[model samples]
Target: MKAPGNVIGFPRRSFGRASAGRSEPADATDEMSDRLLAVAEHGDRAAFAVLFRHFGPRVRAYLLRAGGDAGRVDDLLQETFAAVWRKAGQYDSRRATAAAWIFAIARNRSIDAFRRERRPEFDRQDPAFQPDPQPDGEETLATRERAESVRAALAALSEEQREVLRLSFYDGESYAAIAIRLGIPVGTVKSRARLAFRRLRAVLGGRREELR
Candidate 1:
């Protein structure tokens, strides 16, 4: 049997307890977003525990989709939540729910890690040090929410469709690139992407109408 702190090889349950001063959240019925904001506003450890318990696996999966290796995924997951702990104060619920906010942090951190890993050497003249332009707050929020909607829609896709979409869109790979990486034919890659996009557009359109 696994140990108490063990969570699918992440070993975070004990860390959550130590940081939050409570056991990990066992309740499945809890609303996590409001609880996460409560942690942000009041430094509530129990709320933190709930947030970690709920979002940890999803964040880990997000990191993997962004091309994070198995070796670094755990470290990246820890760093992602640590930033959440520190920057939760900056979270704006009017713009993003707790889940979207968490994902944005994870995505940005994963990109940073990917850039660092891909650089063979550091040079002062390296353009990597130059800051990329940031989207304005409203634009950033919209992008994050759109990403959240896409992620939700992805869960509804067939696994094959989901895998192709993740590689092409999230990892920014071309059809040929994904074919080589996945050891599949280029035509099949294009087919998968076309179908995935069609599904995503339908799903997102329905979601927009529901919001009205």
Candidate 2:
């Protein structure tokens, strides 16, 4: 959904400018986090207005730098913040800083734009589209067991640790990219990833011993 003009209460033309050169202060970040929590818990329009004003131009600049068309960047920016508003309850400060969570949403919006632009028409009759051969009973059972073990190990992790693992391995994002997306230092990203891996190894290793 587009950000309502009245809701943002800012000059639309200003969105073309980049905010990256400016460094956000620690106190400002803490205040933003508190405002976000306020919006999540109370549906406070004033708090939301604060977020929209702060993030609107920044997200617009980010989308443009990420190769988004200037024409569509405004729409993407609106959608990104709209998602933040709708999904505020899902935000966990323990998992990521406010900026990181917001930028991650912006990154997804940019990726979605690219996917839409390059999407190919599906061919139902193509030989390459054939389904894979069904696995034999033993193979299927083995696969199921392995998947269950991995799921269990993952479940043992804290939410923040699982997010690092997902972004690093499942999403194939680089540590630097994850740092940018999550609004943390690269060192912090690496620490979380290292800790996550150590925990996974301990959990999975214990399961292997049990199976043996």
Candidate 3:
């Protein structure tokens, strides 16, 4: 039997890339998208297996880059694809490519995990403040699902755009600090962040309104 949390085995063969170290042609992503859509439409375990092999490591790497615990990454990995299994049918290829869609799932899962472990700060000055109400399971999940659309917006960003945003928001770096670390000027860091935020708002703003 497969491991308890895993839906498929790790594939020994590398996918999409050729043996000569050349990147696969453009259709490779589209092919993966079609396969994922197949799993969505027909519940194909074999197709899910292929996707797990291709994206599993990349998702884990994303969580790691966002400061997830090494020990928990495997569990997070399991949770992410489990969600993919349940929610794959909702994926819209026209709105987001398969890889981008999967990454959005991973991002939302990470956010959910963070929320579960986070403790809110307390301040004595506000008498009107009350503790956050605990959400029922269905409500909690609904919120996480909504975050997927926002993450899809993030997936549209260029790597440079995403990297700066990750450094600034995920790692909580100041603009100057990010510039220093990336060996770029502070103006460039700010520019990248501005462009990323603009794109995110442009893409996610309407989606957020729809959820409302």
Candidate 4:
């Protein structure tokens, strides 16, 4: 009962076309935000506190919609403000209102969290931080072969399987967030992630040891 869309519809048989009529809280929020930014930019902690008090719940709601946890919302909220403090100068009215910018930051942080989780972990050579080196020529061949096998297995999976895996592993999103985003049941997300991981195990067998 939904229309096909190269522009919008999902590329699979499952998820229905999302409604196109949802409105943003942008305009109603911008006025308060601009003033707050101006005050906070001048190092007004009281004003900054006011802004945070007012906007904190809004930001939490926004982040939740973007796939975040209730438990971690406070942590993310703190990070969002810290970012606002550091990047106040980056706010450009020509693009977005202050609230919109803040909201966008929250959304981007959510996505960035996803992107970061997709990367291989760093090693601790200096007891601080260091990037892991990539495989060399001969080792690269074996690595590439392994990558190919993973890709092939992933390619052969149902779209549902691949998507759940991507959201969990690649996006670092939780089951609830994935369910809300995909507009499916929470149980469905959990089940699919489980099924996908199982299939991945079947595909990789002993070679999946590196992931653990």
Which candidate has the top score in TM-score?
A: 3
Better of 2 and 4 by TM-score: 2
lDDT digits (tens) for residues 111-168 of candidate 2: 7785555534444357878643443454333322343456788998889889989887
* Model 3 Cα lDDT, one tens digit per residue, 1-212: 44434345322232433233335343345556666776787676777888888899888888887667998888999999998988888776655677878987787777777655663444434797774444345433232234455667888899999999988766556799898999999999999999999888776554444354
| Residue pairs with backbone overlap in model 4 | none
lDDT of 1 by residue, 45-158 (tens): 666776787899989987887787887999999999999988888775645667767877887787778875552434334677753344355434343355467568889899
User: Candidate 2 — which residues are off by over 4 angstroms?
Assistant: 1-27, 116-212
The RMSD of every model to the true structure, in order and in angstroms, is 10.7, 15.5, 11.1, 17.3
How does model 4 fare in lDDT? Answer: 0.62
Query: Who wins the lDDT comparison?
Result: 3
User: Each prediction's Cα lDDT score?
Assistant: 0.70, 0.68, 0.71, 0.62
Candidate 3 to truth, TM: 0.54
Listed per model in order, the count of residue pairs whose N, CA or C atoms clash below 3 Å is: 0, 1, 0, 0
TM-scores for every candidate against the unseen true structure: 0.51, 0.45, 0.54, 0.40
On the 0 to 100 scale, the lDDT of residue 13 in model 2 is 26
